[model samples]
Structures are given as C-alpha cells and as structure tokens.
Target: MIKLENASYSFKKGFSLSNIDLTIDDGEFVFLIGPTGSGKTTMLRLIYMNILPDSGVVRVGKYSSNSIKKRKIPQLRRSIGMISQDYHLLADRNLFENVALPLHVIGYSKSDMGDLVIEMIEEVGLTGKENHLPDELSGGEQQRACLARALIKDPDIILADEPTGNLDPVTAFDLVKLLEKVNAEGTTVFMASHNYSLIKSRNHRIVEIHGGKLRS
Candidate 1:
C-alpha cells in the first residue's frame, strides 16, 4: 500500500537521497538497514507525510503524498503509525491520555474509547501504568506508550525509525517480538534500524538504504 518511484530528497545543499524505488505490500514486514546519514529516516519521512520529496512520486492509500492537502495530513497520518527514535508524546498528558488523544481527535465515543484504549495498553504490556505521565516513565516505557498510541490507530502500515535505539538488549528483543506479533495479525511494518544483529534472527525481507539509493 506504499509505493515510491524514482524518489529523491534533498536537504539544503550537501545531502540528497536519490533514486529510491520501493513498494511495500499489505501485511508485509520489511526492514530498512544502514549506517548513520544514509537516508533511511529521510525515506520514512516521505512515507509518513512529514516532508515532501524534491523529485519523483510517492503514493499511499490512494493519496499523492507530494501534494496531499494540508488539512488531510491528519487523516493520512492516522492511516499510518509512525514510531520514530524520538518518542513524540505530550509531556503534560498521562500515558492513557496520550494514547487516547488520537481516538478523541478522531471523534471516538466514550463507549468505544475505553475498550480500545485498554486493549492497546494491554497489547503493549502497559496495563497498570495507564495513569503515569510521560515524564514519569523511563525511555522504554515511553517508547511502549508510543507503540500503544500507534497501535490504537489501527494503522494499515507502521513506519518505525529506530524503535529500539536506546533500549537494553533484552527490552529491544522483546520489542521486536512485539512488532512481529503485530505483523502476524496484519499490520505492515517498515522498520528502520541499525541493529542488524537483533533483526537477523527474524528473517524478514531486509532492504538496505545507503548513499541515497536502495541496495538490492
């Protein structure tokens, strides 16, 4: 449900990601691997609607990302769950509030909200800490909260950039396992990670992005 054709992204004058042609099918778990500054996150930004590409075309769920309407960005983003290395959460809000924020913005009713929020919290294994604020949680807990928030949207595709970058090894492995479970249940996951050793055991389609091009 995500496609890019001859896409390229240029930031200022020194950095450019060129000739990116990628197609991610529904329910497929794909991994994007590379070193620092290799355009991995840049490619994801195109998919997540955070930035427009300098050239070429990108389409997701029948929407042309390069020119999608400003007002529609929220709708488009709701269709895809993005978990970047930096966990984006409202510090003022508690964990439950943060995860339920999306549903609330989308107009989910009180009856529907409780069960959905609780289900997502359970899935992410954060059942009891629902009342804790973002600042009260550790990095891993915050990341889990982010994951719960992402899943609550029930997105068609999940774009995670270094989801486990700073976690301990055990936590990182457990996190990937959680992702695998989500994938098994039909969420298409495109994970960008430099931790190849952790992912090697998963045996999913590994796509390497480096020097602004996709490696075969």
Candidate 2:
C-alpha cells in the first residue's frame, strides 16, 4: 500500500505541496491529472523517496519516509518501477544493454540477465531491435524500451509521470493500453498526466492535483 499523511514539501522557488493525505491500496490502478508544474512529479518523487518530505509521512509498502535508512532506499526502489516523459536511455548503449543495466546493478548472472532482458524486450514489442541504440528507434519505441527496463525487475508498483507526453495520440493510446495490460496482470499503476481526454473514459480512480493540492 501507498499512503501519505499530512505530507508537505517546499522548493526554494516557493512552490509547495500543502498538507496532503492519500492512500492507494495494493493492486489498484490510479490516475493523477493536473496541469504542468502542479506538483505531479514532486508527488512521485516523494513516493519513491528520491526526496524526503519536509513534514509528515509518505509510505510505500514496508518503507516509510520518516524512518527509512539511506542504505535501504535502493532496496525500496528495486520493487518500484518508474517511467517518465524523458526516455533516460544511455546514449552509447544498445537497447538490450540498456534494459540489462538494472539487472547488472543488482548482480544478476550473465545467462539469467540475458534471458530476462530478451523476454522483457519481447513483451514491449521491441524483440528484434535489441541491437539498436536509443537514437535509432522512434520515440514510441524508445518509450517502450523505458517501459521494458522498468518492468524487467518485476516491480510491485509503477509510477508513470506523463509517460505519453512525447508521443502522438495513437502512440500515446497504445502506451496507455500497454500500461493497462500490465495492471491487469496485478502490477499497481499510478500515472500522472494532463491529458484528461486520454483517460476520461477509463474505469479507474482519478485523483486531481492543482497548485500542489489534491482535488479528488
């Protein structure tokens, strides 16, 4: 489960997230809708513990923002997949290598890593492009590569922040469908986006945020 209790944070430039509370049960798919700079990314950052909250608590499963140790942060992150608008792929690495990077970080054996990377690539419809570099693939394909990398670890939850912001409408819809398929298989999904039309008809909980405050 993910929960925030009276959580608040502030940036030096004056933007702040006011006292906020939220809870997302396990195996749920939720949508976060807001305009640009409405604290969407900040919320995800807090959940993932990339930045600690200035007050109150943010909890993801067994980890809590108030007491989690620095050494344990990596372990917490390993169970949570993250996708963003930017592909964040290594410039010099091929798709297979890029997707395999996380497995390497966790010290997976060469044979096991190769099998996992290939399977994930195939899942994202990039099977034959394993040798292609990030720049060589289209934007949608790059995004799919990012998705593959995220899912290769079998995360308990996926935090996607405006994942479709860089693609065409058709491609964007396809990505959402892919996410939905992932959710159906029991991975929790919390996606933040400004495009209401893309998600309006979906049968999921929609949480809105504006000026750093949730409006659900």
Candidate 3:
C-alpha cells in the first residue's frame, strides 16, 4: 500500500507539487491520468522514495519518507516493482539476463534466480524469447520483458509510468490487459498515463492531477 499525506515537493519557484493527499490500497489498480508536466512522475518518485517530499509524509508499505533511512532505500525498492515507457532493457543483455539483474543485485541463489526469472518471463508471455535481445523483440514484446523484469522479484506494488506509451493501440491494449492480469493476481498496480483515451474505458480508480495538485 501507498499513502501521501499533504505531500509537497518543489523543483523551482513556479513548478512544484503541493499538498498531495493520496492513497493506493492493496490489490487495487489505480490509473494516474494527467497532462504533461503535471507532476505525475514526481508523485510516483515520492511513493518509491526516489525523492523525498519537501513536507508531509509518504508511506510505501512499511517505509515512510518522513523517517526512512538512506541506506534502506534499496530494501524499500525491492518490495516495489517499476516499469517505464522506454522499456529500459539492456540492449546487450538477453531477456533472461535483463530480468535476472535484480535477483543478482540482491545476491539470490543461482538456482532460485533461474527459476524466478523464467517464471516471470513466462508470466509476461515471453517464454520462448528468453535468449533474444531487446532489439530482436517487437515493441510489445520488449515492454512485456520490462514487465517481467519488474515482476521477477514478486514485489508487492507495481508503479508503471506511461507503460503503454510507445506501443500501437492494439498492442497497448494487450499490455494493459496483462497489467490487469497482474492486478488480478493480487499485486497492486498504480500506472501513470497522459493518454486519457487509452484508459478511459477501464473500470479502475482514476486520479487526475493538474497544476501540481490532485483534481479528483
């Protein structure tokens, strides 16, 4: 779960987020819809403690921005999954290696790492493409690989920023359906997207932010 209590963050004199109070509960799929430069990314960063709030509190699971230690950020991040528009796959690394990176970072056992990575890849429907590099896959397949990488750790929450941004309409819809399946499996999902039309028909909680403040 994630919660922000009157959280505020400022980048400069005029552009900043102010008094944001939001909550994302366990197993919920919440869509964050906003215009460009509306602070959606800032809000996601705050939830994951990538950046601290200027004031107020941000609570992601047990870690609180108000008091969490710097050294514990990695541990906090391990409990949360992150996906982005660009896929962020390592071009030189194949799907298996890319998705296994997180497990390697945490020093997971070799056998466990293999099992988890393969399971995640299959979950995201990239089972047969384990040895393929990023460029070898289509846009949707690449994004699916990104999703596998994010899910490999079995994180409690998934924060996706414009996850379907680069795909064609049909592919984007398929990707969202995969996200829905992930949510159905009990992982909480909070996705930020600028294209309202892409997500408008989904029966999920939609929160809008404008001018650095929550509009709904």
Highest-lDDT candidate: 2
Greater-lDDT candidate between 1 and 3: 3
Q: Which pairs of residues clash in candidate 1, taking residues 3 or more apart in a chain or in different chains? A: none
Candidate 3 per-residue lDDT, tens place, 105-207, comes to 8889888788888888888888899999999999999999999888888899999999988999999999999999999999999999998988999999999
Score every model by TM-score: 0.95, 0.98, 0.97
lDDT of 2: 0.95
CA RMSD of each candidate after superposition = 1.3, 0.7, 1.1
Model 2 CA deviation exceeding 4 Å by range: none
Write candidate 2's Cα lDDT for 82-190 as tens digits: 9999989998999999999889878898888888899999999998999999999999999999999999999999999999999999999999999999999999999
Estimate candidate 3's RMSD in Å.
Answer: 1.1
Order of quality (lDDT): 2, 3, 1
Least lDDT summed over 10 consecutive residues: which range in candidate 3?
Answer: 110-119
lDDT by residue for model 1 (57-169), tens: 88888789667998898898999988877899999999889999889878998788998898899889889899999889888888889988988989998999999998988
Q: Which stretches of candidate 1 lie over 4 Å from their true place?
A: none
Predict model 1's lDDT versus the native.
0.89
